[model samples]
Target: MADIDAIVDDLDAERADLEQVVAGLDATLWRAPTPAQGLTIADQIAHLNWTDELVMRAIRNPEAFADEFEGVLAPAHAVESISAGSAIVNAGTVERSKVPQSQLLTMWRRSAAELSGILRALPSGTRIPWFAPRPLSAAAMAASRVMETWAHGQDVFDALALTRPPTGRLVHVVRLGVRSRDFAYQLRGLEPPQEEFRVELRAPDGGTWNWGPADAPGKVEGSALHFALIATQRLHRDDSDLVARGEGPEEWLRIAQAYAGPVGRGRERQRPLDAV
Candidate 1:
């Protein structure tokens, strides 16, 4: 059976963590641009607000995507494009920090509460929609939320240079990401390589590190944090402690993307993160 409550709890924990970071931000720091172009720290948080709300809306009306999902790549494309467009409009009109830090935190808290209520009220095993790799279950939706929140949380942490101990939760996404490796490559409009690569991630607790194809020779082993950081594209391949034992590692690293939807190259910033 899928663990529904646990997945929901992860979202709760994620919201609390986000509140901790944003509630205490210095105004100037909040205004600082994050890795995403044209989005400052505050804008990112606001975007999160919009997204979480949309997830609730999706739950309420699962058929919203039904009519327009007929064309090639229509489903995922429509969803992602609409989402990206919403953020653009918000950026153009909404203040990055719309509510005060305290109130913003409060608003998020309430918003998440609403989402939780909506989710709990849903029938389990509901066929929620997503693009590529097929439609997902309600449980899968929860997991995706965990991945989204955790990945974006990494952005806020990187902005503040605030480090938190790694969580085993991250390993789940890395494993899922590897399983979806073909989709990631396809998003780049490329065929996935047939040769599998060994993937190893050291657990935060120093337990057995888990990873990719068991029979593959070349191994990429690193701390769970590094694996998560790179998989989420928060850290560039070469910048993290990630090391490929041989050729396969480099090949895999070149197109790693933890998030779903169409794949895009990681942006190169004006200054190297290491240098800044």
Candidate 2:
């Protein structure tokens, strides 16, 4: 079984890394546009804060979370579409963006801390309600938070033209990416391959992280950082260093998504700095 406490600790570290980046930024920098269209660096943090609060509510009171989820889905129920749900989610970020950056940061820090506390105290095997197809265990939820913080932090870093060094905590994201392979295909209305694909990634500490059988017909190999970026839709596949050795693995790499939601509009291909 996964270690819930350790995952929550990594989630805390991920939040701290992002907090350090944004905490140093002035108001002007906070308003800078990110790769996510129409969303500023402030919006990124606001979105995180908003989601963290919602997740906290889900953990603390599942019934209330269900009511809110129903309200969010009500408008889209007629058409059976998630666009309305998406808009409702986006609206939270837009509304939260009105707060002063300093205040927003304070709110985010409080929410994040409270969330970690709640998760740490949560009983083992307890499932937390989510907007997902099913409830998630405390450990999965915490790991998702880690992936999200890292992904959104990437946008903030890109907006400020800064680079963050890879950390051991990224293993959570890599694991999520691998586990979501089938979901990624299913979400796109494509049938997932039956056979598992071998995944071999070079970790930040010069260790190889392996998943699946070594003799699997399909394989994906690359830097863990690049794989995480691709999975999170932070980096375009064209710009990544990953290699896919078979058709199934290749297709999966092209549309990998480690996040829960409708399909994401991933980053566009960029010219290399040297080429530019």
Residue 11, candidate 1: C-alpha displacement in angstroms: 2.2
Estimate candidate 1's alpha-carbon lDDT, on a 0 to 1 scale: 0.67
The global C-alpha lDDT for each of the candidates, from Candidate 1 onward, is 0.67, 0.88
State the lDDT of candidate 1 residue by residue for 1-276, as single tens digits: 777777778777876787787777787987777765566777667666766665675566667654333342245464355345444435532553576656666666776788766666667668765443466677677777777778767777767778866776775567656676666676666777787778777787787666567878877877777676666766667667777888756777767877664454464533477773
Error of 1 at 104 (Å): 3.9
lDDT of 1 at 97: 57
Clashing pairs in 2: none
Clash count list over all predictions: 2, 0
Deviation in angstroms for 143 in model 1? 1.8
With a 3 Å backbone cut-off (N, CA, C), the pairs that clash in candidate 1 are 199-211, 199-212
Per-model C-alpha RMSD? 4.0, 2.8
